[model samples]
Target: MEIIVAKSAGFCFGVDNAVKKVYQLLDTNNERIFTFGPVIHNDQVVNYLKRKGVKIVNDIDEVNEKGHIVIRAHGVTPVIYKKIKDKGLILEDATCPYVKKIHNLVEQKSSEGYRIIIVGDKNHPEVIGINGWCNDNAYIVNSADDVEKLKKSDEKICVVAQTTITKEKWHEVNEALKEKFENILKFDTICSATTKRQSEVEEISKVVDLMIIMGDKKSSNTQKLCDISRKHCPLTFKVETSLDLPQIDVEKIKKIGISAGASTPDWVIEEVIRKMSELNNQEVTKNEVNQEDFNFADALEESFVRIRPGEIIKGKVIGFNANEVYVDLGYKADGIIPLEEYTDIPDFQIEKEVKVGDEIEVFVQQINDGEGNVRLSKKQVDINKAWEDVEKAYNDKTPLKAVVVEVVNGGVVASYRGVRIFVPGSQLSDRYVKDLKDFLKRTIEVRLIDFNQKRRKLVGSARVILEERKEKASKEIWETIEVGKTYNGVVKSLTDFGAFVDIGGVDGLIHVSELSWSRVNHPSEVLKVGDTVEVHVLEFDKDKKKISLGYRKEEDNPWVKVGQMYKEGVIVTVKVLRMTPFGAFVEVIEGVDGLVHISQISNKRITKVEDVLEVGMKVDAKIIEMDLENKKINLSIKEVKPIDPPDNNAKETGENKEEPEITEHKEEMEVTLADVIKTSEEVKS
Candidate 1:
């Protein structure tokens, strides 16, 4: 059997970065410095860093400035940053650059208007850092389907990934979010280190009959490597030592491939090899050659790095055509990239920008297309370059300058750095941008969120300026409302019970009964659209945010000075303001009215009130009685009567009466509306 070994097999850029940060602190700072986490998932690197003076701390309370406190490469939550800041302790951020990107994505996306979904283990330090940065709540989903948490919004959603997660898993989760939201902002934050290792494992499994993968159990990227490799060859086993090898058919196994994770040192891979060589009677001893100095030049010579679908590459423009371009890579052949690859490159006049023989760079997308042409990409190349610039932009805390490219639901699409970032309706301006059309092609500043380079999704905010102004507006209006003082208020809304008026930032209610001085059939009768009227604050409960507002305050009490207006048995002119079954309502003054009882309409054989007068008709009536305390007025319309009956019904009724009658009866009543109104004023006093 032929032996095959894979290339691109060990520590990635982030892991290397994390490991170096921890060990470097040991050389200068003797003061006890603590890693906010274990530094990186690699136990070997962590153990080495610990010997060099780096220590692990799990909580804020556990941290103090003995010398310095370092945030680990996995990153820490913003909550952690605030706690450290509050303690007045020194903080040294050792978080990997990729992890910091996730933090900024959560912070900006959550602040504007996006439901943040982190597709990673919630227990992981990187994901925890991401969730902590968000102002709006963010949830973590570890697998393809996690129902306990889902996005809740009518607006679009944003999705991000952990830097260590595999590209394939990220894609699966991204597609799932697309099922729910009409538009999804997905950021593929999966680091290049993770995909490279997974691809190496996949190739190794197909060639080898038996595989030994060495890694720590807690290493996420290591676990993914085993998972990817297992699909092609089921005979693979993950172990930290030679002791984990099960009862395999050792006699039948000939060709074996051995690889180690980032956390597994080269010495460990040698130990496993030494044990395997012993079984096959091959003398590969630790004494002859040091495994630490093992050469990988042979592996490199045989291997040609391949970029799978969804992998990102950074390159530059070299040459161009109407349909395609040629890029000079250090690869075996110059890469041929299609024009479609530059979908996001703006205003492309390819030949004007690029010329032949220009040293251009690009992503090695595919080893070969069916036509013997190696497929390459410029867009993916730009994203990788953009990430480097974006990281700088975040560190400076500067606003992203961009232009609106398209109008999407609940937001506008703005292009920055050859990538489109979503600007929510609430983030399009300091206040809502009423005319989004006006924003088209207009340049503005934005703070981004939910950014994941792997998924290519981002959300941004511009409304922090708006909310500050809103608070100022609210404060100015609150000072004007006063209880028991009438002022002009405009009606805002109508209901069966009341009308709500916008006095300022708050609202006040005018009960239907308080709408008019008289009994109103409906409040609409006295108030119309845009009516300006005086009102009084009857009650105010600031704690409850409620107010009892009153209208018609201009009409004062009618009984202010009752004794001077009317006396018993006075005659007056009045107009019938309204009619009731028991009496006719008559107004004799501007603010006063009285009732003329039916019995007081006439003293003769009169059966009906319409015979003398109808509503709105003026008449003379006598004030037969008065009640100042109760505000009642008694008047009569028929004080003068004929001395005898004119018809048979009256002729029959008159035989029972003695005739002091007609003159006394008609003269006893008859008063005018004006007299009754004045009398009501007198009685009310």
Candidate 2:
């Protein structure tokens, strides 16, 4: 007998991904592993997992320990996700991407004020999950009769299908809804694998004497496959395992066909094919038997591509279109990469960027039997290489430079050799940077600070490189810096007491007291930020790297020439600088000041210095006492008053110019009295 097996059978992408996720968790995680539900409807796989220590948890509350909770391939409601997250449980979502798309589509449509209508079994987990996205406002209908029950309404409506629903059922439900609503948005959310499997069943069942459908009894897709086969061929049997195979009359059956559901495993289907082959006769005519095509197990195995998830494989570009590129992976089925999974390059032209016969490396995203293509990702391969390069740089502590491409929240994104890296706002500068966007479009050197290959993360810091450079320069500066050496410095900052200057590599303090020979109240009065000034190191602590700088040139001090410029009894013009309680301080030179005692001003008795002297007033004074050691000069303004000269008219009148002589004698008497007053004032202490 000739045996024909459907190509699109056994473990569709979604179920396979879910099962593999559990196996992966079992291999890596030490914590007790649990699946949110029976990972699949298959009893064999579930029992196998039970033997392997994987517990099946029906409800989230059944889990009392801290571990991971994997959402099954059928997906879960938003409330279940919330409960898992609220309980602080690690969640591994293995929801088929197609189901995720349906959830998103329904959510978007409902948010736009359309009444969502789901055409599928309401109790199905996939339908329930999609309904949850729309806040359960979706009208679930399984048949055209269910749509006939829907009340007539003017509200706009959107409809989507269950991933396992047949194309004919979707069209029938849509036609029923169209009769009731004028504005209806319909989306075929059915998984492509389901469509291909149903179609294969129909094609293989025609002209076959008997048909075998494989999968669990509870599997909706498997039941659909069986129904499709039964319509084309009357003698059909649905079996969950080899033991469930019906009693067959080997002599009567000339041609047999096989098909399975999306959830059926390959091994289960292989066992059924083996059982059927054992029941068949080995010898038959070529026209009646077609012996070359009777090996159903090997044919199914060959058709089921030998590929593992996440495997990197090499392939040649075979074809391209606007949304996908096709590659020949040297397997039964060609590989296809969607435009979204190809590259991150902006406005990428796949036609120009890739050509037929060009060999390319791809990451196997999923074994998608739905589309009859192996879903591959070029971007994932590039991202993997990018992460490796970033990890190497982080481990080696090497510098990496990249051009900032985009600015995002909390940081700016940069790309190095096609890998994106994040530089946090704080790490953008050695000092605080308020606007991270300022670095955009600029090339910056950064040190890789952190990396995670699993999460596909790369963190970089420009501040680390800047800090290292500063530290190195500081060490060099400390080793060379010495007291009594002059260096050019830039004013880095200023305070009330000092100006900080950067001399080559390190900052030193130029105290306000050392800014100039004259008194200064604030450093800003004589120095400002970024001003270059010559400074000499006065003191330094190498261990602390603290250097004290002197900005005023010693020879520039006006007091240095005090001995030559002024002496005791020397007369000079002085300005009253300030009034004190006991005396008036006067400036005799730019940097030199003398104190005029209250009693020395006008030779008058004064209660306060302000009573006899006004500030900023110029007057003549005699330097009475010079304390060179202490840089103090005492002056007497009253003693500097000119004595009256003899009158010329009195000399002409010969008026005994004795009056003029008497005047001169009176001046001498006044001088003598001033000395006596000074002596008395000095002795008052």
Candidate 3:
């Protein structure tokens, strides 16, 4: 029997590191050693540690002795860490680096005002640890439906995954988050080693007659390996040791495969391999059928083509269904690409994208021995090509075309082929973009601003594209632009100080002071995005590409009518707009104002302008002076015409001349002006 061992079978890097930390701790100190949980999932390893006097405590309170405490590979929450510290226990943190990284990410994102969402089992220790980093405020979800059940929030969301989760599941949950939220941040925290091991087991299981999966039954990753293998090979067995292997027909099984989970030790796997070899040898001697069977096996081997895992090959599309696509690999083995192995296209339509006789590159995932078929992945091939293209673009300073799939926190997601590129909100446009959702489903050209293959991160900038185009357009505009020339433009954005208008391809700033004929506090009061307006070029510099625009018409200045309409000593009702220590400025109309000096504020001595005037208070004033060239006006509140005195001759004649209109006007003016001054004095005292 040919025994094929998976390359990734054995303890992964994280598990190996954790196991080594325990042994290293044992060698250093004679004091009692304790772990917060089982050092690993395997019972044999835990028992072996127990023999070394290592105690496993679920809670820190269980430990009475002051000694060394080692955290398990699956880390504990922040509260546990603080408790350990409070007890003054010697801490030998054995948390897997990958899991620790996820903790840090969630903490940092949460502290940055982002609502944290952890996509993993809520009960899992790793997820619990991650949630603790964010004060347990994180939304823990295991499936896409959980995302839908979440309460809608406009708060920026940051999503992270458990290190052991499958990439497919991670993508599914994040995709759902995209649909439910307009501003989401996603981090693919699934460990690369976990993915490779699962993929290797899936590949090896298809090509073997019988598959043996080794790890403890309680190990979650081990159970996942068994599930993946059983789907491809019917003769699949999960065992923790050599003793657990079931009786097998060694003569019937010509090929066997072996794979182990991340927690399984190397010695256990070696023992299982030794036992299988011994069983096969004993069967050969007892049956005495090896010579005849060898000839049959040789003939069978010659009829089928041999393919290794991760081999890049060419294939022709033959047939397909909803779940899988059939391909002819030009060998005896027929190839098929499963739905998970296809490129990640949005709302992917297999029937339309794939057709018969279409040649495509595929990465060989598995080669079946019994059925003489292979498992292939077009997605893997495409991923490799995309990485190469991304690297090239980064080096060449070239722009790439992509579709904006979703708007996320701090960015938008633009995809090319199957690769997702992050474009920050600040990078989405040359001007500030308030609504990122406006770019969704639109094709955008972007330049790579940051690329890290090791971290599997790519950042693009659409602002770079916008800036490049604006630079060219600005150059052309400066060549012909002149002062006093009016250009029809659209409002691109607004700010407290100004409005940026897009004239052709260039942007010009219309200062808030020039937005209208009246006083304006913000640009939004008179202008908004996409509003078409005519603006005159006030100033421009070709070298700086700075264009200042004026939207207020020259003929619309209200000060021009000050001298013609109102002269000195003219009584008018004015509203107080603002006050200074020396005087008060009152608006005569919507766009016109006059200053009332402290000395002229009242018939009584005015110690302060506010003593007689309150903002928005209306009072009658006489225009004392007007300088139209300087656009300044002076007014006197005390100089208003007085009410006529009651007729004394009528009173002497007993003519009943009360003069109610004249007396009432005098009383009203005195009371109105006196109440304001009295109120101000009352507030001060």
Predicted model with the maximum TM-score: 2
What C-alpha lDDT does candidate 1 achieve relative to the native structure? Answer: 0.67
Candidate 3 per-residue lDDT over residues 1-685, each given as its tens digit? 8777777777777777777788778888899899887788775566566556787776798788899998877887899999999999999898898899988888899899999988888977778888999999999898889988987778899989888877778889988888777899888888888898789888888998999999875677887788899989989998877767878886798888888888887777766777988875632111111111112223323544566888998876755778888775645446889877876555668888876557899999887623335788998888789889989999999999888888787889998866789998998888777788888878889999999889989999989888888888766777789998989999988988999999878889999999988979899999888999999999988777789999999677788655567888788899999999888899976788889887777554445566556799888989988887877889887788332223442454334455556678999999999999999999999
With candidate 2 superimposed using the best TM-score fit, by how many Å does residue 683's alpha carbon deviate from the native?
Answer: 99
The candidates, ranked best first by TM-score, are: 2, 3, 1
Residue 319, model 3, lDDT? 58
Task: Write down the TM-score of every candidate.
Answer: 0.40, 0.42, 0.41
For candidate 1, write residues 1-685 as lDDT tens digits.
2334445455555655665555566666667777676666644444445445565666767755565677866787767889888877678887778878888877788777888888888877778778888852776777667723465446757788888788887877777666666767888888776676677778778877887777765677778878887898888888765545445455677667666676565555665666776675654312222234324324322443445555554433434558888553433333578876754444567767655435455666676564334588766766677777666665665578777778888888987756678888878765345777778877777776556767767777666534455567556645655678665667866887878875544568899988866677777877774576677789887677788888865435455444477777777788988877676888855556878877777555545555555778887777777786887777776763312223443343555454456656656555455678889999999
The better-scoring model by TM-score among 2 and 3 is 2
The digit string of per-residue lDDT tens for model 2 on 187-283 reads: 8888887898889889888989999888875689999988888898999988777766777777798888888877777777766777877786443
Tell how far residue 468 is off in model 3, in angstroms.
99
Candidates ranked by lDDT = 2, 3, 1
